[model samples]
Target: MILASLLRPLRSFRCVLLFSILIRIGLIIYSEWHDSRSVVKYTDIDYRVFSDAAHFLLNPGPENENVAQGPLKSLLGWKISLGNPYTRETYRYTPLLALLVSPNDWSHPSFGKYLFALCDIVNGILIYKLLVNVILPSSSHNAASQPPNKTEKHASGPQHKRDELSRTEIEALATTFSAIHLLNPMVFSISTRGSSESVLSLFVLMTLYASLTKRWDAAAIMLGVSTHWKIYPVVYGVACVSALSGGSVGSTSWHLSLVNQKTIRFALLSAFTFGILNVVCFLIWGHPFLEETYLYHLHRLDHRHNFSPYFYFTYLTYPPLVKQPLDSESLSSWNQLMRSPLTSFVPQMTLALGAGLYYGHRIDDLPFAWFVQTVVFVNFNKVCTSQYFLWYLLLLPLILPRFHVSRRQAFTYVGVWIALQAFWLGEAYRLEFLGEDVFLSLWMRGLVYVLGNCWVLVELMKAYS
Candidate 1:
């Protein structure tokens, strides 16, 4: 009778939890609807590029614009605007995303944004599932072993036999973790926009999940699709190599290991598949796709102190040479300087890759996929904006189950990120007090950006080390 009474309340509590989750999902859907109707405004420069690419895809362009700038751009153009031609300087590198969202043009931009936002919500759910299914399993097992009641203890049995987790525990942990990801302000902000990052993140997480399950074929396909969306996902292949090489069978050292035959085969297959696709794109579109999509990244020089330590070197050593506003006749010099790598403060991207490889060996264990990805990303030569937090966020639940920072520390880190976002979003409270000095505002904002990313990097280094 006593046990039955206790079980009744527990069952009621579970029911309430399920109800709350359903309510939250409903709220998220409603919020997305409200946000979508808010506006069709560009929050960043990349938005313009993506929007232009969408237009180009739906309407063919002249020879200048018709030439493929990237695989995605070419693919989207072929899909949306088969015969007609259009021309614009605002061509983008990511046309696949535009293609995916193109079907919704009949509705307002809000509808498209809402669709993407829902995708983000789905991504958050997947992250939570990974945390429960992949990361928190061991923790849940541990928790299950220590029972509070005699009946619970008897039911669980000895510690040696307590490897499996209960469904309830798994669901609870998943729900908690999922909520964290769902409410993440950065994710919310980006998903509400029509950019590809949210979709890219979803694919990346799916790849990680597939890889964790040792479903190499599925993992490879997911990764291939992910890379098609954003080039950065290609680095994940290197991480896969590192993971498979860490075992005892073939080579003792990661540098020389070729242990797992299955993993090796899968990696090779993925590489071949992506390579073939690239070749096909090349054959279809030729040089424009190669130059504008692939090579364009090589020359991008954003004037901001991004997360990489290299940004500090560029900002401090060689400031960007801005030309005074002038007539069109004098524009050639400006363009020449902008295109010159010698004048630009390019970071040593190669060195960063080498360094990441070195450190990754020290930190990554068993399923080294996420660890290797995080290490490589942190060391990349280019700027690491706030949205790139998704890279780390996806991996954290996988790699850091045993690790626990204090609640205070977690809150402090979140607070810093919020402050940094405020500055980046041009909502700096300090700016309100400081008035119209552009230099002061820039300096203050830049400092916050540098510090926030640096703090994250430092935390990552410590965690991995």
Candidate 2:
């Protein structure tokens, strides 16, 4: 009878594995189909910008006009003036990212797209591992806490616990989450488009996983590598520091114990190793590469339509803001108008530091720390894009395991996002009347932007209290 019972589960497992493989195959087919067409083109402003950087990297030029673009181009190889018909005069925004896009035969546009898709696949795998091995462990513990059934009781005790998850059961759960990550529309869209979000997310997940295992050195190195990719990852470092400190505000046992000599030593060592690695990378790559990746992003004043609260308010009061096209010269004026007193460059830094210190004091509870830091970072940023949504998406599952919300509520939240995504696509595509009606499109996009983040803030407040 026991053999029959086990055989039934094995059959179910094989069925699930077959189903998963089919779904993955379907997704790959869809991705390839989408890549073949230029059916949707949104000016390709960012793509053109990055492509120019790639060109400059492959061919270095005089510093007179090129110096202002930033130092990242040097990393691609000493710039040569390849006076090719394809070379257009434009500045590259992201040099390191551009390097990845550059290929020996600069003719193929799909090279970078394929590379990003691969990163996206890797990201899905990492997230699956994190969920199954780390986050789901807590969920399983909660499940085990419930009273066992009569059959379970008969076979209960430590032996039953061991049987609860065989190697196959564990692998199934991992595979399920991995499939979910890959199918997620957000992941699929970004991966095929050559955006930096997939790469940044992979690094963030690695850093989080390392922290969860209490491997300070590995976590710190991951954090540094993430920042090297994009500045936004730095906010996660604050989250990590806060997590290392333990719980919300208070003098708990975890907080009290953090002051020990051994803890302090590990913390300092991690920080030193992270700092040195970043510094060395910056020096080897040169200041221009570091500046393009880190500093140039700081000076970006491009207010070319985003879905943040600032965009919504500006559109509501001054509809002209949406109509005005962005230009290099007008950037300074736009920055001056949209800039907030509290979130000024200096004040924002202060707030980040303050939040870091407060969270660091209570480091034992990393999830809560990550939640708070994500809230602060998103709320304070000047512009919020659809891709930025992944930051919250990645962190939400981690936080969800620690807190309980009704299944209905979870579904409702996800449903709202799906509706918003529809609106976002309509706006991006400028579909029919929707595209012509600039105010309506802007409002729809802006609403999604605000509500999505508002939900996160509400969740964070609950976690804090």
Candidate 3:
């Protein structure tokens, strides 16, 4: 019995998941050691930022009375705290994240790293469920990219109807998805670097899973939690609402039906959940809650050493000029251009909204639709980071099985992504680390990044269409 159990196919998933998790843990330890020794290690400043936040969370100190006075006072206190070496950080993440990391007792960085690694494990399990329940079940054998086996064809008979996946096939697909997620290079890099994107990824996956299962109330709360953590998931909420209400696909135009009972309940539940969380945070942390978390992002603009396509445009127009940092005053012209209604923000928002509407039209395979919508959303985002790639990369395995692709297209896609990333990294290394900012090279790098995304978007449109 023991031997038979060990040889079982289902057990393969267990073995794979365990191995993947072990590898991630090893990577986290390796990264910590690497960062300690090397100035140009893989870890970003985010690790330090989060550490500072985590430290502040445990030791908010006697500063609370001052912080509670007003947003201005709170900002001033935070600014003052920054100058002090001992207790010098304000929390920018949601309280839930602070609470999640608080159990480590502000003891060591390992606690947070371990917590993130554990979240990756949970994400692996969630990916497995997403594939089994949503992706596998919804696919028709005829519609699958691969041709059906002889047994499958026989089962369907002369009428040639599609056959459901067998239990064995379903388990295999689930295990495959779980492995891809757990062993993903991007996921490993993010988790090892102690980035909170892992936590965000978990809530986002839960939101997708809950929505796909028709658990509207749960979906709403999860969406609320995710959005409160990082603002981008709010874009997903639009897709969530549309998926719940259902959409008309065949036509060119699409509309959201707010009158639908499901949509109404989802909206109210989500708003209440999100509002309550923020209100509780306000009562406890006061004005600083909004100031540090949400408002900070509104004012935040990173024109230097970023991968955004718009970065080079601002650089060319504003010209940070040879190691001299571009001040806020200098960027005012670029900012004005970006904020203009006819340019920048409006077009990106319109494209994202249109993509969401297009994806929502599907009633049977909403998960795949949701994945496509997320890809579109991230691709067009105002700011694109390597870490942000995790958002849709995690979802691709679930969606890829549904589409048929030729070798040429696949090669083109992978080549485009890698080539673009490689070029950007090479230039970024020179500009950031080597202190060589060849002004023209920066423009070329940004153009390559933009073109790479455009190439990717075109491929996605071809595949999904």
Which one is best on lDDT? 3
> What does the lDDT come to for candidate 1?
0.55
Where is model 1 poorest over a 10-residue stretch in terms of lDDT?
Answer: 152-161
TM-score result, candidate 1 = 0.67
Error of 1 at 46 (Å): 4.8
lDDT of candidate 3 at residue 296, scale 0 to 100: 65
Q: What is the C-alpha local distance difference test score of each model?
A: 0.55, 0.55, 0.67
lDDT of 2 by residue, 406-434 (tens): 45555666677667666666675664344
Evaluate candidate 3 by giving its C-alpha RMSD to the native, one decimal: 6.3
Tell me how candidate 2 scores on lDDT.
0.55
Backbone collisions counted per model: 7, 13, 0
What TM-score against the true fold does each predicted structure earn?
0.67, 0.67, 0.81
Which pairs of residues have clashing backbones in candidate 1? 60-84, 60-85, 60-86, 61-85, 61-86, 68-289, 69-289
Tell me the spans in candidate 2 whose CA falls farther than 4 Å from its real position: 1-51, 61-94, 104-108, 142-171, 246-248, 252-291, 312-337, 340-368, 419-452, 456-465
Error of 1 at 265 (Å): 2.4
